[model samples]
Target: MIKTTVIALLTAASLAGVAAPAYASAFGDVSPEFRSFVADSIVADLNQKGVHATSVEEWGDLIRAYVTNDNGTQTMEFFTPGSLQPVTK
Candidate 1:
């Protein structure tokens, strides 16, 4: 009886886990083209700054570009990738 109870509890837990809501990413609003443009611009800016970049990634509504400076230190920035005119903070 104890074994059956434990199995039932485990099955219930598994089912509950499966029924949990799937996470939706916040980046659903931005288009792929815009993201690409933003990433490209960031890479260009980094290059201008004399930073050697190896990769860039788009996460949700932000673009993270990784750059390696001459000193061999890696850095990243989160920017909203878009063609819209830049806004002042």
Candidate 2:
């Protein structure tokens, strides 16, 4: 009985995650391949490193990253797809 209860709770939690609402994403003009790439490679890594991962915009080799901050000032970061570090002009 105890084992069955644990499994039921776990199943409900899994379903809850799948039923979560969708929010706006930052990327644009991305291919299907790139979409999975961003979710698996980019978003997961960024959030793990304490960066409030928001959106990724791609243009050829140039990728734009937007990270929300607490202050009023807004900023956008740039980078190459393979390079996780932000690029500066």
Candidate 3:
């Protein structure tokens, strides 16, 4: 699980770099584009947490995603929206 999470973070960072050609660095007052990049990365991370997850929705500081479990749908929440840490409720 740790290995998967690490890979996810690295993948997100890579995607962000590709999304923005002018990406300077990973820290300090980054651009709005960088923030958006981070958000996208977070969403991807959430999607993988629940193997059946089909969609992701961002609400304020919480990140909500839907997954189709064996019986029905399950929702996953992440309290920290832009966190590199794994999905936290």
Candidate 4:
């Protein structure tokens, strides 16, 4: 009984891992053109604000921006999909 439970638990965990990406993708993947537009707009806007944003890309249901700081270090910032507002933890 113990062995069977362990195997079942392991199988369930494996399946969950496999399904996670598909579940996230069900949120909808934007087209290449839309992604490019978002990236370009974010880069321009952030740079204008002096954030030194290097690039941006779609990350699951959010947008991830690569930023370089004045101290010569890099960091990642996440934003909402449509509104482009920063996501707070």
Candidate 5:
């Protein structure tokens, strides 16, 4: 019984891990063009802010732009890339 339970749990966990990317892709597809646009905006904004942005990475429904500022490193999040609108509080 214990072995079976462990196996089942492991299988479920593995499945969940695999499904996570798919789920994220589906949600991210809401606005692929928008997301890309937003990401570009973010980079521009960061540059104006005197920050050097390395790249923009999309994970699931979130777009994270990494920047290196004079103070330190920072990450900006946007719902869609095209809008470049900051996620509302």
Candidate 6:
């Protein structure tokens, strides 16, 4: 009986994780595969430009990147979605 109870509790705990909601991106309505592809492209381009880019994501209709600077500081940079051009204020 004790073994059965322990197993039941463990199963429930594992199931709770599976039932949890996935983290949503800004463009959650769009397909995840497309978004991943775009983000990956942006990362690759930025790295090629020697930007030291860490990660990229879609944010509010723009592509946002986390970049590390030569001074060891991190900053957020915005870019156009398709062209991947830097967006300046």
Q: Which tens-of-lDDT digit does each residue in 20-70 have in candidate 2?
A: 111123234466774654444455445566666676655456656677777
Q: So what's the TM-score on candidate 3?
A: 0.38
- The ten-residue window of minimal lDDT in model 3 covers 19-28
Give the poorly placed runs of model 4, Cα more than 4 Å off.
1-34
Better of 1 and 4 by TM-score: 4
* Top candidate (TM-score): 6
**What are the per-residue Cα lDDT tens digits for candidate 3 across 1-89?**
99999997888679666533322222224667766665455455555654454554454444455556778857564433434233542
Count of steric clashes across candidates, in order: 0, 1, 0, 0, 6, 0
lDDT per residue for candidate 1 within 1-89, as digits (tens), equals: 99999977875564345322111221234568754543454555445555565666756555456767678888765544442112235
Any idea what lDDT model 3 has? 0.52
Q: On residues 1-89, what C-alpha lDDT tens digit does candidate 5 reach at each position?
A: 99999977875575345433433442345467655544554455455655577667675555566766577857664444434345676
The TM-score of candidate 4 is 0.55
- For each candidate in the order shown, give its overall lDDT on alpha carbons: 0.50, 0.54, 0.52, 0.65, 0.54, 0.65
Per-residue CA lDDT of model 6 for 1-89, tens digit only, reads 99999976865564345211211333345467755644555676678777788998767877789999999999999876555678999
The 10-residue segment with the lowest total lDDT in model 1: 18-27
Q: What is the TM-score of each candidate against the true structure?
A: 0.38, 0.48, 0.38, 0.55, 0.36, 0.58
Give the TM-score ranking, best first. Answer: 6, 4, 2, 3, 1, 5
lDDT for residue 34 in candidate 5, whole number 0-100 = 56
In candidate 2, stretches whose alpha carbon ends up further than 4 angstroms from where it belongs are 1-40
lDDT of 4 at 45: 57
In candidate 5, stretches whose alpha carbon ends up further than 4 angstroms from where it belongs are: 1-51, 74-79
Superposed by TM-score, candidate 5 places the C-alpha of residue 56 at a distance from the truth, in angstroms, of: 0.7
Pick by TM-score: 3 or 6, better one: 6
Candidate 4, residue 72: how far the Cα is off, in Å = 0.8
Error of 3 at 40 (Å): 5.9
What is the C-alpha lDDT profile of model 4 across 1-89, one tens digit per residue?
99999977875574345423432432245667644544565576567667788997767777688989889999999876545578999
What residue pairs are clashing in model 1? Answer: none
